[model samples]
Target chain A: MKLTIIGVGLIGGSIALKLREKHFVDYIYGVDYSEQHLREAKELEIIDEASPLENAVKNSDLIIVAIPVDSAKKNLESVLALINDQQTVMDVGSTKSGIVQAANLHKNRNRFVAFHPMWGTENSGPKSAISDSFTGRAGVICDKEDSAPDALKMVEQVAEHLEMNLLYMDAESHDVHTAYISHISHITSYALANTVLEKEREEDTIFQLASSGFSSTVRLAKSHPEMWVPIFRQNKENVLDVLNEHITQLRKFKSALEKDNYEYLEELIRNANKIRGILK
Target chain B: MKLTIIGVGLIGGSIALKLREKHFVDYIYGVDYSEQHLREAKELEIIDEASPLENAVKNSDLIIVAIPVDSAKKNLESVLALINDQQTVMDVGSTKSGIVQAANLHKNRNRFVAFHPMWGTENSGPKSAISDSFTGRAGVICDKEDSAPDALKMVEQVAEHLEMNLLYMDAESHDVHTAYISHISHITSYALANTVLEKEREEDTIFQLASSGFSSTVRLAKSHPEMWVPIFRQNKENVLDVLNEHITQLRKFKSALEKDNYEYLEELIRNANKIRGILK
Candidate 1:
């Protein structure tokens, strides 16, 4: 298949490389607004050529719209408008509801597949792309029924080639679940980093004494603002819902600690420990 | 030299194993309140023998009070009462102010060294012991002047053998710094895990959708409450202070998201990204 990846950055570049490595993609065309990213993608051999968005779309069998959620929502609609019925289009945004809803009434709606392969790091850009980015992680296909069977099959093949376990859910449910599990983690980490930075002005002390635990918990704080600020904004309601609950939990802990109620704090921690059984 | 580890749990057990592996000690005596732990320590070869607290302290050239912070404060007192001037004593508790205060006016006060090694995992017990547990991490020796020069030298020897970088600070500062850097991380993790569990009732959804980011942030929540509850109790003031600051930060993110203030959200995340420089 001739694959064209719009916004050839981390997610798009990784998929293009993985698909090519597996011999599933005959040729990959990269389309990125940033001249630097387009050049880097080609230089890194993530794509066979860097082409204009219109030229990339006209010549490719499969088009992958991989970008930030807010941008992806706008680009997905524009891409859908230009793609023929035979050419399959897909997006790998962290969010699904916005992009999916944006294309709800598109003429070639069935040609588009909405996928979110649930794996990422605090890093971004083409340099951060790696071949095994999707291995052993969940690849979510949102609202599969809305897509043509051929479009869905192509995405399924991509997921299989990358060794991801494919899961199907509607866009609404996908948004809610990800807000519960993924997006809130980044927000919490960012807040935590800010908290430590604000309260402890001596960076050297925090640097020397920080355990592996502190580093891991604050790891997401290093994520790029260009990606996360939009995510929090796009998924505002769901993010706010979880953030409110998270704040309530934190306040409960604060109250218990303030009251010297070690028993209450102990109970909260014990309840939290149940996540071990749930997660691992 | 003869070495005695009074609490054969994670920190103490790992120290015994690492020291034994390095051939730093002629013999190790394991002392614990739990008979099962003593047996496990011997079974794991973490110690040459499981002996009574008094017997262990009486025979060993160096005694390590590797117990809970609250318990270490009491045990340090009684152990100092039993030890001769030639016998050196040190502790591996998370907090130092309480332990240091308990040994304040003891006749053998000079014999005890206060140390808190900056490494741990969610797992515990003698079975969790491993070689090189403290390698490349900071091992703090608090209030070095309060300890006799010989006693400080013995603890310094153990740190070198375990390949830990020894850092020195007064007990009060150590307690305050740890609360900001280490203790607060665990509390935030526990609260985050509880928030997810309380709001997201479907355990399977949380399990399947949770990314590495979520898992990393909440990993410390699985810490054994027996170990953490006491630390929080003993360091209540500092822990509470950090928790309050953390909550305030959380509220800032919550307010931004609720009000659809992307600019404020962006600023908060940008500030958070500063941790990247500090941590790395």
Candidate 2:
């Protein structure tokens, strides 16, 4: 199948690499407003060719709206206006409810499938893309009943080819669960990095004594702001809910520590340790 | 040289494996309060034999205390009572100021060298031990001037044998730096894990939908609480200082998101991205 991946950054570029490597796609056309990213994607051969959005959408069997969440809604609206019943449209945005709502009224709503593959690295841009990025990860297909049967089947086939496990859920459910499990993590990490940076102004000390635990806990703080700010804005309510809960948890811990309530602190940590069973 | 490693859990067991694998020590003796861990350590050949603490200390040329921070101080106090001038002792605890102070007036203070190898994992016990665990990691030797020259030489030799870079710092400096970098990370992770668990309340959702970002950020939450509680207690002041700063940073972020201050959020993330330069 010929596939056109718009905004070929980390997720989009990785998808292009995997599809081309597996021969699931015959020709992959890339489209991005960033001229530098487009140049890098072409130079890296992540896609077969770089083309205008209209040209790529007109010719490809599949059109992937793989951009930042805010930009994704705009692109989805434009693509829905142009795509026909035969060409499948899909998006790999982290936030889904808003995008799904934006395209809900389109006559071609049945052609678009909203998805979020639960995988990513701290790095971004086309240079950071890797082959087989989505393998062994879960791909959430949201509001699939709204999509045409053929469009859903084609997207599922691609997910299967990429070795991704398909999980079905409504767009609202996807946003809520993602806020709880994914989006909040990024915010926590970013806040943590800022915390350490602000409090420990002595960079030399952080550089000297920082261990693997610190690096792992704050790893997501290095994520691209341009990509993530929109996600937090789009999924504002769910993100806020989780954020408030996180702050409350931290306050509880602080109060216990300040009061020298070792027993309470121990119980809290012991409960947190239960996450191990689920993570494994 | 013969070596005795007390408390053959994660740190001690891993050190035993590395020392034996590199042939740094001729015979490795293990001592632990847990009979099961001692048996498992012996079965895994993490030690040549499981010996009583008294016997292990009497026969070994070098003694490594790797128990929980509180137990470490207590054991060091007892060990100091029994040590001869020729027997060199060292510790691999996360915090140092308290341990150093407890051992300061001991007659064998020169024989006791305080060291903290900046390496660990979330998992614990003999099952979690791995060979070459300290390779390429920094090992901090606190108050080296207080240790006997021969004792310092033996510890430095072991660190070099494990391919570790040795750094020298005073006990107070080590405690403060570790609190800022290591202890704070664990607390943040524990709180984050609890936050998500409290809010989501669904095990299946966290397990299935959690992205790499969440897993990485909360990975340290799986750490054994028994080991961490004492570190926090020992380094309470520094930990509290960093914790307060971390909470303040979160509040700043919350206010920014509340007011739709996208520009400030973007700038903050970009600044946090500076960590990438240092980390890499």
Candidate 3:
């Protein structure tokens, strides 16, 4: 199949590379607002050619909208407007509710599948893309009933080619779950980074003394604001709910320390240790 | 040299294994409150023999107190009281000020060197120990001026054999710096894990959707309370200070999300990106 990858950056570029490796797509046309990214995508062989959106959508059998959530919503509408009934348009966005809702009113809504692949690194752009990045990660198809069988099947096949475990959920639930599991992590990391930056003036100390634990906990702080601001903005209410709970939990630790309640502090850490069983 | 490692758990077992690998110690005596741990250490070949505290200390030239901060404070004093001028004692504790102060009142205070190896994993026990865990990490010697020159030199040689970069700082400063760089990371991670566990009752949803970023941020939550609670207790004031700053930072994100202040949110994230330069 001829694939058109819109916003050919990390996720889009990765999908293109993986699909091509699996022989799932014969050609990939890269479309992006950034000319440099498009050029890089082509030069890196992440895509076969760089083409205008209208031209790429006209020639391709599938179009994947892989951009920031805010951009993906409008881009999905535009891509859907240009595609025929047989040409499927799917999005790999972090926030699904807004984009899915945006596509609901479109004329070719049935041709669009709302999907999210739960895998990412702190890096961005085509150069950071890896063909096997999504292997064994969850590829969520939100509100699958909203899409036609053919459109959903094609996206499922694409997820299979990327070596992902397929999951189905409603868009709203996906947003809520992601707010707790994914979005809050980024917010905490960013805040933790800011906390250290503000309190620890000596950068050399942080460089020399940072253990793997500190590095792991703050790693996501390196993620770009361009991608994250929209995620927090789009999932504001859910993110805020989780963020409020997170602050409350942190305050509990602060209170425990202030009161010298070692028992309570130990209780809290022991509770957190329950995650070991879940994650491992 | 003969060496005795008090508390034959992760840090102690790891140190014994590495020092043995580097031929720093020809004979190892594993001493711990738990007989099972001593037996495991012997069986794992992390130590050559399991001995009582007095017997181990009398026979060994170097003794490492690798217990929790609270226990290490007492253990250091006891081991110092047992050692002579030729026998040196060192500790590998997360917090420094309390333990260093504990040793200060002892008659053999000058024989004890306060040290911290800046590395750890969430796992615990002799089984969790790895010989090369401290390689390329910082080995901090706190209040080195208070230690006898020969004692300090012996611990420095141990750090060298472990392949660690050596840094010298006072105990007070080490506690404050660690509260920012290390302790706060553990507290944040534990609080984050609690936040997810409290908010997302559906464990399967979390398991399915948790990405590498989420896992990384919460990984330290798995750290044993036996190890972390005393670190927090000893560095309570500094940890509380950093924790307050961290919560304040998190609240800023909350306010920005609540007020739809995307610009401020973007600014917070961009500032956090500064840590990338410091860490990488």
Candidate 4:
């Protein structure tokens, strides 16, 4: 299959790299607003060629939208405008509703499948891409029923080729679930990094002591705001709901410590330990 | 040399296991209040024998107090009371102030070293012990001037054998820094885990959407309360201070989203992105 990856950065680059490694695609056309990223993608050999978005979309069998969510919504509309009946266009944005809505009235709406491959690293760009990054991760397909059977099946086959477990959900529920599981993690991480950065002036002390639990907990603070701001903006209500709940939880922990209610604090931590069942 | 590890759980058992792997100790005495932990420690070969506290302390050349900070402060007093001039004692507690103060006026005060090794896993107990766990990590030794040259040197040598970078600071500073770097991470994680567990009642949704980022961010929430609660209690004031700052940061993020202030949210994440310099 000929694959075209728009915004060939971390997620897109990883998909290109992995799919190419497995010979799932005979050729990959890289498209990006950033010329440097396109050059790097080609130089890293993450894609076979760098092509303009229109040209890439026109020439490829599958076009993957991997830009920021807001941009992705616009680009998906653009891609749907140009794709023929045989071509499939899908997005791998974190937010789903915006993109799905953008294509709802499109003539080729059935050709577009809203996808979110649930995998990433702290790093970004083509250089950060690695082989088999999405293996064993859950790939969420939102509003699958809205898309044509063949279009959905093609994406499912690609996902299976990538070794991901397929999760079917609507766009609204996808946004809500991601707000809790994924987006809020980045928010907490940003808050955590800022918390330590604001108070702990001695960076070396933090560097020395941070490798324990702090590193893992604050790892997502290094995530690119370009990708996340659009996500948080697009899924504002869901993100706000989870963010509000997260703050409330933090306040409870704060009060527990302020009141010297070590028992209550212990209970909170013990309750939090239950995440082990869901996580590990 | 003979080694006695009191409270042979994760930290203690890991130390004993590593020392045994390095052939640094001829015999290791496992001393724990829990008989079950002692039996597990013995079976795991983290200790050469399970013995009573006094018997273990008196028979060893070096004794490591590897319990929670509150327990370590009390146990450090008991261990110091029984140790001779030639024997060296060190406590691997997260907080150093309480442990340091407990031995401040003792005749064997110079014989005890305050140590905090900056490495741990979310898992606990002797079964969780692994060789070379401390390698390439920082080992903070508080109040080196207060310890005898020989005693400090002995513990420093053990740290070197474990391949840890020895960091010397006072007890108060160590506790404050650790609260900012380590304890606050756990608090953030616990709060985050609780927030998701509260809002996302469909545990399956979280399990499906959670990937590396969420897992890493919430991994510390799986930490044992028995180990963390006492550390939080002993370092109550410092923990509260950092927890307040973390909550404040979270509130800023919440408010930014609520107000549709994406620029401020962007700035927060950008500032958080600066942690890339410190972490990676």
Candidate 5:
């Protein structure tokens, strides 16, 4: 199969590397608005060639939209305008509702399958791409029934080849779940980083005392703002709902600590410990 | 050197294993109120023998108090009563203020050097101990000037054997810096884990959508609460201050998203991105 991955940065470039390594694709083409990224992707061997978006879309058997969420909607709309019944279109954006709604009215909407592979690192760009990036991670396919059977099967085949577990949900449900599990984590990390950086003016102290726990909690703060700001904006309502609840939880902990309610604080931590079951 | 480790759990047991493997100690003695942990520590070969606290302290040349922060104070107080000028004593607690303050007026104060290694994992107990855990991590030694020269030299030798960087700071400074960097991260993680676990009731959805970002952000939540609760209690004021600032930052982000202020949100994230520099 010939695959054309749009916005060949971290996610797209990683997928290209994996597909080529697994012998799942004969050739990989890349499309990027940034000429620098396109050149970097080629230099990194993430794609065999770089071409215009239209040229890549028209020639490839599979087209992957792996840009930021808002840009993904625009690109998906354009792909929907040009795609035929035979070529499969898929997106690996964090937000699903906007992209799904944007492509809903297209005549070739059946050719598009919305997917979110639950795997990423704090780094980005073509330089950060690694082979086998999505192995053993969950690949969520939203509203699989809306896509053509061949399109769905082709995406599932790629997922299986990459050793991913396939999960299905509606677009709205996908957005809601991601807001709680994934999106909120980024916001909290960014906020926590800002909190420490703002209040702890003594940068030397932060560097000196930073333990493994602090490093783990603040790891997500290093994520690219360009990638996450649009995600929070696109999924505004769900993100807001969870953000409010998170703040409320923090306030409760603060008050409990202030009142020296050790028992209540212990119970709260015990409840949080339940996450161990779900994580592993 | 004969070494005795009080509280034969994660930190204590790991130290014993590393010292034993390196042949730095002739015999390693374990002392814990919990008989089960002592047995487990012996079974895991973290310690050569299990004995009563006083017996272990008397027989060993070096005594390492690695108990919970709350228990650390009383344990140090008792150990100070029994310790002589020849027996050097040290602690591996998270917070330093309480322990240092409690041991200040003791006759054997010069023999007790307060230290906390800036290394740990989310797991706990004897089973969680790793043989080479402290290598390459910073080991903060508080109020080294107060410790006798021989005692400080002995503790520095142990840090050298483990290949840990030894940093010296006063007790109050250590507690404040740790609260800003280490303690706040655990609180943020626990609150984040609870926020998601509470909002996303469906375990499957959380399991499917959880990316490396979410897992890394909440990784500290898997930490043992019995070990953490006392640390929080010991560092209550500073933790609360950082917690308040963290909540304020999150609220700023929440309002930004609520009003769709993408520019402000982007700038906030850009500021958070500066942490990458310090962390790396």
Candidate 6:
């Protein structure tokens, strides 16, 4: 089947490459506002051709709106308007509720699937795309009941081709869970990098003494503001809820330290250790 | 040279394994409060034998106080009191200032070398120890001017055998730098883990949706409390200083999001991206 991937950056370009490798799609049409991304995606063979948005949507069997959450919401309306009942549309934005709600009022609503393959890196651009980026990860299809069976099935097939496990959830629930797990992590990393940068004036010390632990915790701070600012904006309420809880939690540590309550501090760390069982 | 390691946990066991591989030590005597650790270290061949503290110190040519910061401070004096001018004593604790100060008034203060290997993982014990753990990482020798030249020279040679880049600084400077680069990262990670654990009641949801980024940011939360509490107690002042700065940094993100200040949020993230140049 022919596929059109909007915003040929990391997520979109990776999906395009994986689908072509699995023979799930015969050709991929790349659409992006940036001409450089389009050229790089085509040169990297991530997509077969670069086409205008209208042409790409009209000529493809599947349309994947893989862009920032704010752009995805606006573009979802335009893509749904252009697609016929025969064409299936999907989006791979980090947050789902706004886009799902935007698509709800569209005439071609049933033809659109709200999907999020739970995988990402700090890096961006088509050059950072990898074919196995989503392998062994969860591919969540949010508000599945809102999409037509055929539309959902095509995305499920794409998830299978990408070697991802399928998960189903409501869009609101997906947004809340991501805010707790994924979104808050980015905030903490960005804040951590800033904390070190503000206080540690000597760059040479950080360069020499940065252990793997420090590097791992601060790695996500390298993410682009263009991507994250939109995510935090679209999921503002949920992000704020978790961010407040996170600050409270941190204050508990501060309180324990201020009072010289080593026992309470140990208890807090021991509680945090519970994540090892859940995550691994 | 014969070596006595006075704590067969992660740091001590790792150094023992690496030094054995380099043939720098013909015999290693493992001493730990936990007999199980000594047995495991012997079985894993991380140490040649398990010996009592007094016997181990008397028989060995060099002594390594590879224990928690609290224990290292108490044991440094004991080891120095037992060792002659011919024997060198060193430590591998996270903080250097407290222990260096504790040893300052000892009669054999010149025989003690304050060292820290800037490499570790959340995993602990002899089982987690690896011979190449310190390779290509920094080995810091603090307050070297206070130590006898021969004692400093022996520790420098040990760093070479471990294949680490050597850096020298005063103990107070090392403590301040680590509080920014290392200790604060752990607190953020622990607090982040607690934030998700406290807010997300559904454990399965976190397991299903936790991305690589979340895992990377919270990996240090798995660190053992026994090892961390002592370090925090000893470096309480510096840790508190950095922790306050970190909380202030996090508050900027909170304030920006609360006011819907996307421009400020973008600026915060862009500023954090500056760390990429320093770290990599």
B1-280 per-residue lDDT for model 6 (tens digits):
9999999988899999989889999999999999899999999999998999999999998999998899899888888888889999999999998999999989999999999999999999989999899999999999899999999999999999999999999999999999998999999999999999999999999998888999999999999999999998888999999889888998999999999999999999999999989997
Which portions of model 2 miss their true places by more than 4 Å? Answer: none
**In model 4, which runs have C-alpha deviations exceeding 4 angstroms?**
none
Residue A62's lDDT within candidate 4 is: 92
User: How closely does chain A match the true chain A in each prediction, as TM-score?
Assistant: 0.98, 0.98, 0.99, 0.97, 0.98, 0.99
The total of clashing pairs for model 6 equals: 0
Runs in model 3 lying further than 4 Å from the true structure? none
TM-scores, in order shown? 0.98, 0.98, 0.99, 0.98, 0.98, 0.99
lDDT of 5 by residue, A1-280 (tens): 8999998998999889988988999888898988999999999999999999888888889999999998888778788777788999999999999999988878898999999999888899999998888888889999998999999999998888778889999999989999998899999899989988987888877886788888888998999988999899999999999999999889878988999999999998998899998998
**CAPRI class of candidate 6:** high
- Put down candidate 1 lDDT per residue, B204-226, tens digits, no spaces: 88888888888999999999888
Residue range B192-218, candidate 2, lDDT tens digits: 899988977789988887778888899
Inter-residue clash pairs, candidate 4:
none
Model 1 stretches astray by more than 4 angstroms:
none
Candidate 2 lDDT tens digits, A91-196: 9999999999997989899999998888899888899999878888999999999999999999998898778988999999999999989988888888888887
Q: Per-residue lDDT for B268 in model 3? A: 96
* CAPRI-style class, candidate 4: high
Give the CAPRI rating of model 2. Answer: medium
lDDT of 3 at A122: 92
What are the TM values for chain B, all candidates? 0.98, 0.98, 0.99, 0.97, 0.98, 0.99
Question: Against the true structure, what is model 2's DockQ?
Answer: 0.78
Clashing pairs in 6: none
Interface RMSD of each: 0.9, 1.0, 0.6, 1.0, 1.0, 0.6
